[model samples]
Target chain A: MIVSLTHLDTPAALIDVPRMQRNIQRMQQRMDNLGVRLRPHIKTSKCLPTVRAQIDAGAQGVTVSTLKEAEHCFAAGIRDIFYAVAMAPGKLPQALALLREGCQLSILTDSLAGAQAIVDFGQQHDTNFDVWVEIDCDGHRSGLKEDDKALVQIARLLTRGGSSLCGVMTHAGSSYELDNQPALQALAEQERRVCVSAAQRIREAGLVCPQVSIGSTPTALSAQNLDGVTEVRAGVYVFFDLVMHNVGVCRRDELALSVLTTIIGHQPDKGWIITDAGWMAMSRDRGTQRQHRDYGYGQVCTEHGDWLEDLRFGAANQEHGIITLQNPASLDIVVRFPVGSRLRILPNHACATGAQFPHYHACEATGEVHIWSRLHGW
Target chain B: MIVSLTHLDTPAALIDVPRMQRNIQRMQQRMDNLGVRLRPHIKTSKCLPTVRAQIDAGAQGVTVSTLKEAEHCFAAGIRDIFYAVAMAPGKLPQALALLREGCQLSILTDSLAGAQAIVDFGQQHDTNFDVWVEIDCDGHRSGLKEDDKALVQIARLLTRGGSSLCGVMTHAGSSYELDNQPALQALAEQERRVCVSAAQRIREAGLVCPQVSIGSTPTALSAQNLDGVTEVRAGVYVFFDLVMHNVGVCRRDELALSVLTTIIGHQPDKGWIITDAGWMAMSRDRGTQRQHRDYGYGQVCTEHGDWLEDLRFGAANQEHGIITLQNPASLDIVVRFPVGSRLRILPNHACATGAQFPHYHACEATGEVHIWSRLHGW
Candidate 1:
């Protein structure tokens, strides 16, 4: 019980501090070499200490997914916060309050209507806002096409309506699907090109688009250069998971986040070792299922962080995980993983898995554990 | 400014209180007709008001998934709480604390080693626990086989060790895979028979196996008769989801839980309307993917609670949901779902999606809303 994770409750989120620092250093150094500020997305951890570590590692201000997150980061003294998702008109008051409080906040939008609402609300509140237009480099989830005519229209709307145009940003989230370096690097370049091109189009309309931001954990690490980009905003790199591991960006050993679980029961005949960590702990993010290597629910590891390649986390209930052998030959699973034995599971998505916990058990290299509270709920 | 769901923040969990009460009434009446106690599993809502509604509707005890949930329910004056997962030795101390504090907490185990540990811990603490043996009915997740030889061994171990063997319980979690009424009814009967058989096996060994508990949302709702069962425990039935709907247990209109989101941006070319609610709000539970009808992520509905059958929630990032048309045709999505317009997304799995929020905006029949806080994390 001397500060080790062994005594903590099962299905607890464990953050290997050394691995986390190393991952952060690696991402920050890469961005530095590429001459771009790393505005680390705090949406991944939602933990102030982790975000502080990123800041200490030469990363710039944080990027948030929700205005609630923006408020939390700002309260933590992080002034340069960027709300990366398109601003919904209903949340304008929340953003206005954050900006009025002296937080250097930037909101995003990809549509003319969204931009108009933001500009209109800012004017109504008599507070000018720094707004970034979202661009879609990859045909993924959100954002407008890089070459869309709406790019200049939105930029003109923001700048003309007394809001500061803070350039363009895009996340090639599709990079998570690629496992090859060449393809990832190409996507990263495409992300950079698309974002810079959007900024170029905005600037051509006589509006000054100052910064061009682009990233995703895979793209940021695989990018050859940031010739036109000014800053990179990447989450998940702070706590790489099996999804990133499958994407060929980080090693399994570098996955800083894992769910510490205990063997509770077993179905020996079925070659199964039932664990207390479930999809609720690892999240329902079967991110690697479509990747090169599908880590069923998660990659199973020993209590000391050693991977158990022979076993796979195949199924999970709300609070029970099913760990079975890949080959299913007799290995005396009951004896090998008896009741009360501890194991760690590398998650499919760090953000999704981390959200399942209220706080993380930060395990230092010295085996000393500390509880770092997380900001949950919007 | 009215107390309506439309005024709440986007990506909020909404519970139709009237529908919830109706669902509760329906389940309670079904259990009454079947001659069994209704030990409502509180794992789905984890909300005090919701649980109180269940108790108000004649639910005898509450079933929880974690000790944290037990603590919450106990603090809220719920005494008969059952932690249904196979007990881990590591959690014995936490369970002991709850028991010592006068929580009528019933713990579970299916393994001999687990039973031994629980008995030993109870003895060491100078306290006796009411323990229930878990029986595997449908080979779903966790539990011992109904006829496993270990059943007698575990029962004898607990009874002789001074711990009270309360009963045997089983959950036909695999019933979720069946979409037809006949298969679900068959599985329900099997679930009841297996659990009753396990108790009989223990009783034949001259032990008093006083209770037989069995359920799952689908099984409990579809069970023709629970002849030998003392009580039935079902969680998701309180807020039926699309998974339950596809499982032929509940209808889409009966789904009491939903995520209220606001349209933020659009990819009109791709027939996408990006909403603020994503996997973070809805959870990544694709429970209906392999069911009879695959709801991509969720079924999109109008803010007024009318289902938009043409639209499907296809993909999601952390906070971005991509709502696309099932048949990719131009419906002028941007105009139809204009920015700032509200939308409701019916989740695939109620338990998984409900866990994503801190509280629910419970809307009553009068369009009035109240905040019902939830229990989060262990």
Candidate 2:
């Protein structure tokens, strides 16, 4: 007795297509107003349809974190791609294939050894490759210091060795750790300074560094200036989560994706309601750790996607989540939900949880349902 | 220039088949020595070859965490299964299908509400089901208090209802938090006390408590007594990891599975080497936080499966990992590995990381490699 749309299985991934389209348009409009190219990172939503929607919304190119992602997008006829992560020599064959296929492929590296390896591979294969030096903007992850002399040396080596230098790129990953818009803005400015400084150093070394890229969803959404950045790459903004909301990047209403789950049981005495959505569905992303909010797994939502007042996923295991009502005793509502009641759970990090599933049940603005396949594995 | 094995691809998954086979046999011998039925949990490997090996090693039953796993095993001719996770009403259809197909399915539940839901569903579908009342052994996750009167009441309900009460089950999930064998033994004692106590209570109530089940790799391997217990379920021992080693369950030598990665680039001056395995290849599971072994992501290994002394993954993103040498000043070896140099990474938790991949490259005891398909989706 499966209802057509109301009663699907619990702990399933659902995408609101209209909300996704709106998210894409909103991001594109922001980039346009700031006079920067939008290269939506595909790591957020690995679905081809979502990527296509980004392209359709006026993205000049797209960014990917893996060769598998680049290959998938390139095969799908996306002409330009930035393999934003540092590329290894073993990926040379795949990178060369994308280049041979007339796709504008750009890769990143932060070390001289990496540059030399790429130079040797390019020389051996008799094919030129575009390269970007990754600069550390805020010391969050991998990158070369903007003022590091080694970077200029590596840029000189690549340029002189026939490798096409494609300028510099930096991500303010630390922006995610900021508490407010001012801190995020400061990080954004720091990101611009580092990337612009690195690019200027490369240009001063008698090389053309034309493309400067800086990105972070927080920075991209609120940064006042993109005066030096040519392109921005941010992924999480398209499907904002509770983490994003806590960080003040977007409001709760702006979230476009959630795990649709069912209320299976209730402990009326303890006011504990169990849902089918668990760590396997919502992911083990404790993204709100730095913030004041300890959203156990996620924030519970009403059937129509509104946030349920003061409800939380208090505890979760691999496949079972326990919801403890914040004020269990005071609620006047029917304490027990029926066995088949459906609810949506807003995730803490959309990318991690969404990656766990194969396909998304796309709900249209008119309430039509369609299936969108997501790419998985390496 | 794709080499048949070595240069096939960078950052690929690798299985030490001989080692895994030995691991399987070792666990089986332990179970046999204890005179307990072994129900190997398939959630760790999720590969059919590994599951087949467990069957070959004398496992009478298998434990599964998801319905997808149950479906896969049932199709593969696995007759006896313990859907170890608490059952939800939404999972009724698949559970009923498996039962109808003659697969012996026993589910675990902690509360009377959950049991009653299953009984109602079974009665409505005209199907009989088996159930195990879950007991809280160590307050690690979901379960009923050992001395709760409700346990006896639920046992009575299941006995009189259409469902058959098989016995009582408990998992010492807190055992993983232990740092030594003595601590693990203490947790095991806690596990035994709760399970034995619950079984005794049920028996005193005139219910036939035929089986007492206890699980978790640490407790399963270290338990001194199974006076009232009939079965043991442990998953991670098949692919022992850094976390397991740190927790004194198994040593590094016993680890059987690893992610095969390639050297993609290097930052010689910064002492940073980049590999293809990131959080995607390895998961974000930093198991047992008190271990103090800052396995940045995972331990680095040579192509032949030996630990690369002084090399460890220091940082990771979604698809890129940065490896740092313990001593950066030493230039005794070439500062940079060539692109395509293969490496292997030991995972922190086998179950979580293994689930991300769609298939395993099954390596046999004789060093034969074959592709094993994985089960995905709902």
Candidate 3:
């Protein structure tokens, strides 16, 4: 049943279908121009409909952060999938199940021990697995260095154990911290150079390495050239948020995801409008706190998606969001956002905020709303 | 079917059942001594099994932050429920449905506009509703000030419209900021005093107001006297977190909730152990940041629940948590927490962390694990 926005419940995740489509097109077009396959990260949405939209908009495959997402996407008929996180040994069984069920799933590993575990499991099961060597480009979080001898060591271990070395993938997650274009571009280049170099090192070592994947939203959008990179993976760009806005990747108007809430009360003395969308709805991701612009919890927007510049969601409780006006006592707080009036709050991190809900209320420009179920937990 | 903790999936919410029951018993005993009913807030653990334990431990009723929680608890055979947050007009129908179903749900409102809406809706449907007035005791988030003239007006509106003026409830949520006993005791008294004053004012206006509830984990544990208060509500105390640890409410050992994660990889140079539990598992609630001690993401613990003080979750990405050694370069990071090993991380906020997962792996001292489902979304 298609419902209108007004009829849907408050504190709901609303995806502006047009805006999401536009975001998908923008990223897909950029990847095409860069001569690389776009592996849209489904972790940002974790919804099959959203992934289908990305694939429908020219994405080559889906990237996942968890095995559950891999299972969800693979069951939904997505042939190509990459379980992006460094594979845990205990999770090998789940991955093996997915592969055995006809999923062209690729697992990642940054260390020799991890690769050895994968190879051992594969050899024991008599099934050669497709594995990707993760490279650390910006000293970000996980992955091995481009010059780390372990890269080729891991690749050799996989090949020696009858497993196929699919490629090397690196995420310049630190790109989220860069607001300037030069830094983003430099990091993007660094990400590409490192992964491509890792792939080269493996091939030079008499090992077959077929792909070089690199990206993060900022790096993907700012990369001048891909060169040897085969595919690019990026999440959060599909639903740009306050953090991405502060990072200078997308305009606030381009934010596709928002939490639809209703003003339940007002602390007029403090210029605070208490809404139903708290940290639980907006998420506790104070991602924009250290960014160029700090949106307390989120930026307050009108129900029609217009920005409310002076009003900000400064504090949040479990189910109560305290929206403070820039100029306290300047406006009639109660008169402006009276009780029962609905409002939209653009979250700090789209990925974090989207994960809070079980499903998304895809709101169309024509006032139609459709529920899209999201995959929860690992 | 009972499972073992070691066999469950990584990044799972693990509730130490014995510790939880102990926490419940402590709170229930304290409320009993204070000569008041304890209405344990179900928002912390939105699971029937958890709530059942609370009810079994002498909790008279349950307090809820969302209508969904109210419905869930009511369906689970809970009759007395206080929908604590100020009633959103859009949610009145849901509340009415619960009331019609004999849930004995009490709704709260702080504004005259909200009270009038409730009265209007009640009259329109010819159904008298039990309403509670929310009093602002500490200028924390929501509710009308105890001295505000609107308090009596709202109470009058409820009574005149044939709705039962149940009582006044106030949460000294700001008490979370207090770490010392003196301050916590004072705030507890202040919360009780103001709420009692509001109840008295309502009665002076010739209205029947019986209940007076006030609490925060810190304040509830430190309260010297209940005075005129009839019942109290506190949620996070059930599954004490790092925030409660800093609040001086519960010891680290008493923390019942934790995220069971597996070591996936390591960055030896940086002395970082990459774990599968990231902010997505621990949540982004930096609630202890401004407190006495700031646990970066959480305090790392052994699978047996022993605190690893030398290690800390210094950083987190989407699905990767970087655990850094307190004395970096001292011990061998890889040797200490090798790839595929398991660890438990106590979260900053139990409510926020528990909300991240679909179910909790209730771990027993004897190595038994029971899956307790969680209610998600509004």
Candidate 4:
């Protein structure tokens, strides 16, 4: 049964549940056939219910970017956790605490100093922690060169310090820069070669190098080969946003999350329709910068997730959004949407926009409604 | 005593607490002399401790953009709240609950339909609510023009519906568009005249306009005239950001919050330094779009908050940031910032960036530290 529409306070965030579920199932089924473990990145949905759904979808573990996410997931019975960002000495204490709480925690490090700091923390705590030396495959974010001597030196130092080395992990972050499938495939090969070579070098040094993690939603999904990779950490796959569509990672229909907003006012003379949603509600994520299309701020939607033709959020302030109608003279549809009419907005980056709101108002494809609470903060 | 610098997280959010205290005090003292109530907006900090500090600085009430923010402030002992966005019928039931819980909650609405919806919701819930008709002083966001018939109709409907008419409020969001102090002052007068005219029109229609609220940090701070404004609601004043400095609202010395990040790598050949902090860490707040000077992503700083010369964040990705040195050839001052060196980054828009992280590492202007947790979502 359809729930009666409640007047959502202006600037409230809305999530289409059925779309999210479909997106989740699509990824899970793909990974199931791939024969590698799927560790969905929790940073995408900070919501507990979404994570629970991922676990139910056969995800082997969850990857997070912050300690608070690790703590929240662990408290919610998620045991296998990988803190994907490089670890620091300040966070080691918290990581040790989580490990002692019977949680399997693995951290990434790209620098010798970072490795030394982790070793010092491990020594002081009298604990042997799992360490993953991050390798820079595409020169995207942070990672060591695949052939850098410092990688071996840091790994050897960790091993000498009684820390268990968990092999190497790298993210082909630059894959998002590719404009087509061929470039995507090239990035995938780069990812595989760097990760596989890093693993080989560590093993050649006579050490156990079993786990080699490599991921990026675009690279992971488009990769032609995953010969030596043991696990993939892909987030944003479950709720592909406008950025994904622009980068050739997914299509508009594949995007799951959207901001449900209401038309609050209209400037008929200017052909501007204002919504209750603004940067404060929709987040300031301009994910279209690297894409072929600029969906000015975000793509506007009709009630059922269809892109509203020619409508764009041309500009926004904290609580104000101005939509410019592509053709102000269009006679088929009303240019001035009356007050209280609801509209859905597709975000530029689902992760950043999703992080703004507290709960997800999940709705099935058939429009069945449920509430999902999201965890926030560190 | 200086705290020992160890391996803290690479990209962590830090706030200068002493400067924050001074910021609160200065705004509070200004409002006190103006003989108007200070309903400081919490959208900037979103932190309970920061809100408490505002209260301690003699703020009369709090203003928020979302119900989640109102709920957070209410739970923290803030009784008087103004939900400063246009309210909808679906969200009214929840607002009524706050009223039932003994909190003095007020909401803004700009249309007759919006007012009717709230009235219907109030009837359905059997609760009374305070309503304010939002007025448009300068075509910035959603609001009824002072001379528009819609304003009169909305006020009549709200007064006739058993809901308490708390008068009108307007935000001069365009004040941020001004490039000089004179333009800011002109915008302030325009805001004052528009709001006062709206209040007069309401009173002329045989209605009591009890509170006329008008605010924008620039207008509020530079306004030589606030003849009819009963209260001022400006949030970003407490933590002046780069946007404030760009608009001539405040100087850089007045900015109290910044992102604490670490230099993680260096591309000596490209004259680019990489930091763990990126768009995800500092948020995508490009507040200088309309300003005379575009400060790239944000202003760079040393650990003690001193502005660094010529170093600016040239490009950023979701998890990576590239800083370009002003002079590509200068290598005199130790060309490489050690991998573990910590740096502070000034924000573009304080409200948007502050919402990205969970808590603030509250540090004193003198460099002492504490932690303040932030609340999110409704």
The prediction achieving the highest DockQ against the true structure is: 3
lDDT values of the candidates? 0.90, 0.81, 0.91, 0.81
| lDDT tens per residue, model 3, B306-328 | 99988878899889999988776
| Best-first order by DockQ | 3, 1, 2, 4
TM-scores across all candidates? 0.98, 0.92, 0.99, 0.90
Q: What lDDT is obtained when candidate 3 is compared to the true structure? A: 0.91
**Lowest summed-lDDT stretch of 10 residues in model 4 chain B?**
B1-10
lDDT of 2 by residue, B246-329 (tens): 887787888887888877666656677777787777766656445757576788888878888789786776777888877778
lDDT, residue A189, model 4:
86
| Most TM-score-accurate candidate | 3
- What tens digits encode model 1's per-residue C-alpha lDDT throughout A347-366? 98899999999999998888
Interface RMSD of each: 0.9, 2.8, 0.7, 2.8
Q: Give the residue spans of candidate 3 off by over 4 A.
A: none
State chain A's TM-score for model 4.
0.95
How far is A307's C-alpha from truth in model 2 (Å)? 3.2
Count of steric clashes across candidates, in order? 0, 3, 0, 7
CAPRI docking class of candidate 2: acceptable
Task: Give the least accurate 10-residue stretch of model 2 chain A, judged by summed lDDT.
Answer: A331-340
Which digits, one per residue and each the tens of the lDDT, describe model 4 over residues A144-189?
Answer: 7878888788889989988899889988988767769988998888
- Residue-level lDDT tens digits of model 4 in B1-378: 234224445466777777788888888888888888899999888898888999888888899987878888888888999999788566776787788888899998887778888888877777777999899898877788899998888888877887899989999988888868788888889988899899999999998889889998888888886788899989898888998988887777888878877665655546666776777777788888658878777888987689987798877765567887877687732245665576788988898888877777777655466667776555
